[model samples]
Target: MPRPPRGAILAVLAAAQFTVMLATSIVNVALPQIRAGVGLSDSATTWVVNAYGLAFGALLLAGGRAADLLGRRRVLLAGLGVFGSASAAAALAASPGVLIAVRAVQGAGAAAVAPAALALALGLHPPGPARSRALAVWGAVSGAGGAAGVVLGGVLTRAWGWPWIFHAVAIGSFAVLTATAACVPAAARTERARFDLIGTAVSALALTALVWGVASARRAGWTDPAVLAAFAAAAVLVVAFLRIERSAAVPLVPPRLFAAREVAVGNLLTALFGSVWIALFFFLPLYQQQVLGEDPLTTGLGQLPLAAANMLGASLAPALVRRVGSRTALLAALLTEATGMLWLSRIGAHGSFFTDVLGPSALVGLGLSVAFVQLTGLSVAAVTGPDAGLAGGLVNTTRQVGGAVGLAVLATVAGTVTSHAAGHQPPLEALTAGYRTAFALGAAILAGTAALAALLVRRTPADGPAHAPAPQPAASGRP
Candidate 1:
């Protein structure tokens, strides 16, 4: 049978990815409403967010392997069904416990969907300009979806109700699920490749512990016994996982996957990018709400420029890559990001959105688009066949881990600085000082990432012979 159209396949897959990306940010805007509706305490309110992060980060590796072994199309369908159902259930949840549980389930589904969608996209498109263009679209959608989530969440919650956010997500997810079932081609499956249960268990536990520890650090200090114990447990579990992978017949994560320079460097860059970018997205809104006295709707509207610029940057990435090569493109992107961070660091007690927010947001968004697109291409550059899913999963896993850590660290720093300055300065001045400190630190981190990317990820040839795409042994079957 002939393969499905690449464009159609990418559209469906990108939509699936868009849903996953949207989930990560949408609830953030609705958190205040959720807290009030569910009568949640301040501490309990945070779990509504972290529960999703914990499950998504912990299960990604296993989810990736499942996609390869169980067939990407099959796994994708399962994930969508789970996510859609969870979203619907979450919409009607009356209690905080119910909502948090459903959110965790939604994250679990996203963990499965993310790697499979990426692998399927890679499988459908051959390497070259076609693949480059496809990746650009993928990157743009993912980045824009993330930014749009905050805006959409605000609109839906304000115009309709907070539950409408979940309702909309459910509707969108199921629509994509139906379209994917009809459009995406199925991948060939191998019976010989089995899930590594031991590796999965240990690695999942390690990641869960690590993420849980980091997520709780802001509430419970880093030195708290619970935090220390969680980290210690994670370390031990990681050692065990490495040992198991070394001996297992079919390891969950093959060491050979990291042997590629592009894969290793891409993951490292993504981690650093996630650290700063996620924190920026989180805190910028806080500044808007607290200092500027803007409502959620205005906050979302303020981010529109960033989202638009991000899409523009993604669309321009392929051309940039061809002109400057991937390494140079990444370097330029990082420098842009650092510059944007420095600009945003100047935000003060008295500031206008155009004067203080727009230019910096655009710069940061454009930089994010370029870096993410190029890095994603690099991450899967030489990988082929079943390993494609794993490569995709590793990239996302590292980024999520970095985001978890960054959120904790950045929040603590901003809070500490604000609290310290409150004793000596006016409230607005103290808050601005805290935000400026975070932005400055973020700029420094991006600079460091640029240096590391330059040193580690080499440039692709400006002119090189075309290489054929890697072959997949699986059968291609359309619904």
Candidate 2:
């Protein structure tokens, strides 16, 4: 058969990425409708979101490794199948337990789909202007997907019904699956080593516990015994996973990969970036609804400016990277986002969206999207062949885990501030105070990350080689 057009392949990969990210946030607007429709208790309603995140975040490493051992194309097809089917099931679910279970399945499928899709995208274009542009598109889709989800969820839920949200995902998943099968070429798998079952299990458990603990801390207070136990268990399992990787002939996460400074620093910055990225979405809607007295649909519409800015930034990032070095571009992006966060901190209870939200949203959207592109490029710079999938998975894992932890911590901070302020102020003013404090802290975190990146990241020429060398297979392991 003749090869498919490059545009077709790129579209398929971008669609897959957008779909995965959309699933992460699309249901937020429909949560109330879903809860009432399915007779869910308050706790179960929260699980509708948590279950998906836990499964997705926990299985990412394993999924990425699977893509390496299995063919990336093959894994991508399998994940799409699972994701599509699970989406259909979720749409049909009539009970709370069934809905949550299907959501988890959807997340598991997404976990498999995300890394495979990203690795395939990297393989499609070599390191150059072509790859940079491809990554720019990738970054745009990723950053915009969450914001777009809010809009789509509101529209779909209000127009058709809550189930239409799942229906839309199901339809999109199958469409992407068909397109990928037709357009994406299958590559031969080179790694013939044994799969690291122990490492996969241990690492998955540790990530699950850690994400669950932090997520629980948001609702059940940080001091709750169950939350403490979850954190402790996660710590112990992490230590065990590290020890296992050292001794295992074939480790799930090759410790040597971290020897690449780009991978290390890229992931570290991604974590900090992820924290702010997720928190921004979480708090912005609250400010609009609780303080500005906007409805869900209106709040969703309010995010359009941010989404547009994100796309604009993504489009501009490749040019910026070409003009200046990635290090400099990244620093600039981070500072821009920090400035936006600081601006957002000035939001007031009486503020209007135009005066208060629009300018900062534009700044944040621009900065966040550009920073994501740079970080992604850096993270995978030194990876090639078999490790490409692993690098893809590692970067994504850091982002998701960081977002979860960041949101939890920020929520705690906001809650504390709100409680203390409530004693002396009106309800709306107290809530605004909490939101402002969280945004200020978020700005501080971004500034701190930029400072660290400036100190640690090595400068390289535009379109130049990676700072670190590609990882070699461990001497003890056979390939």
Candidate 3:
């Protein structure tokens, strides 16, 4: 197999990523059923999701390093195997604790698969227009998978049962693993580096503690001593983690990646978008429920615009980048998102999704679709093949950490508004107040991203890197 046909290989890798990410969103819509079937308290069901995120985010860097050392295909297959087995176990679990445990393991498998597959993609395709086109397709596929997951999970859970969703994950995992075995090539052997044991522990603990504090803060007042302590401890752990990274043989995050002003600002914009993205999923259901009086199924349907637009934008991203360059494209995209969010935040009690939500979602999806490709392209473009895995890890790590923090912060803010409005207004009024607060804050976040983009994400032709390639990918030129 002379490289397994580059186009087909890209397709297979894309399929593998889609299936893993699809499992994530699909499970969210099925949360209620999962709780009933597995005997989880409402509070505990949130863990079913968080458990996965915690495992996935915490160990992703380690997984990327594993690919660099153990080989990408090996980790991919191992991840698939673990993910499938865990899905099967999750489907069969009778107790909430057992189900939660298996879900975390399943996420660990995902963490391993995701970064390795991305690293493999970068390796297989050189930094050129072809690869950029492939990446546009790949990024779009991922976004589509996530968007489709909600609908699919809802349908499956309604038709078969929540357990069937996990069973479906098992089936999907097996299919991708088999295809990966055939299409994805194994890298030549490399020396295994010492696993960064101390760094791993610190990063995991710090993230878990930080998210835990924020999530719990809604129940415990912000002034609560425990909340303050957790926040303080998180700051300390972060400082310590940085210190460890500064001296470690293999730093968790390479400091030099931020040397490019564009990369640093681009990543910040990404982090803000990441937060807003998750926040939509978190609070939109409330708006649909309280405002429009739609049920869970109908609520999911309302989000279809975002999904459709995201896929649409993804397909267009490569061409957009080809024309405008990564830096300019990112700034344009951020501005679009900010505009959409501001419109969405202003919706009155009488407003409809068709009028209020759809327009912004369209912009958001389009904006994000373009920005992600450019961000990923710039992150690894300067590095050699050997460092590609680490580059992939760094980008994904930024996303996961951002999502974790952003969701928590937004949730806390929404909760605060809801609490303040509870006695000040009627039930629907209070709920709307809180939802609007979140949306308004999101608007601010996106606007800030736009400003950052203008300042940091744009290319300065005058001060371009000496080694920097041209601004965008050409038909045969590198991205």
lDDT per residue, candidate 1, 252-287, as tens digits?
A: 998878766667877888888899978887888888
Number of the candidate with higher lDDT, 1 or 2: 2
Report the Cα RMSD per candidate. 2.3, 2.8, 3.9
Among all windows of ten consecutive residues in candidate 2, which has the lowest summed lDDT?
470-479
Q: Which is the better candidate, 1 or 3, if ranked by lDDT?
A: 1
lDDT of 2 by residue, 30-95 (tens): 888899899999989989989998999999999889887777788899999999999999999999
lDDT of 3 at 461: 39
Give the TM-score of each candidate.
0.96, 0.95, 0.90
Candidate 2 ranges with C-alpha deviation above 4 Å:
189-191, 462-479
How many clashes show up in model 3?
Answer: 1
Model 3: lDDT to the true structure: 0.73
> Arrange candidates by TM-score, highest first: which order?
1, 2, 3
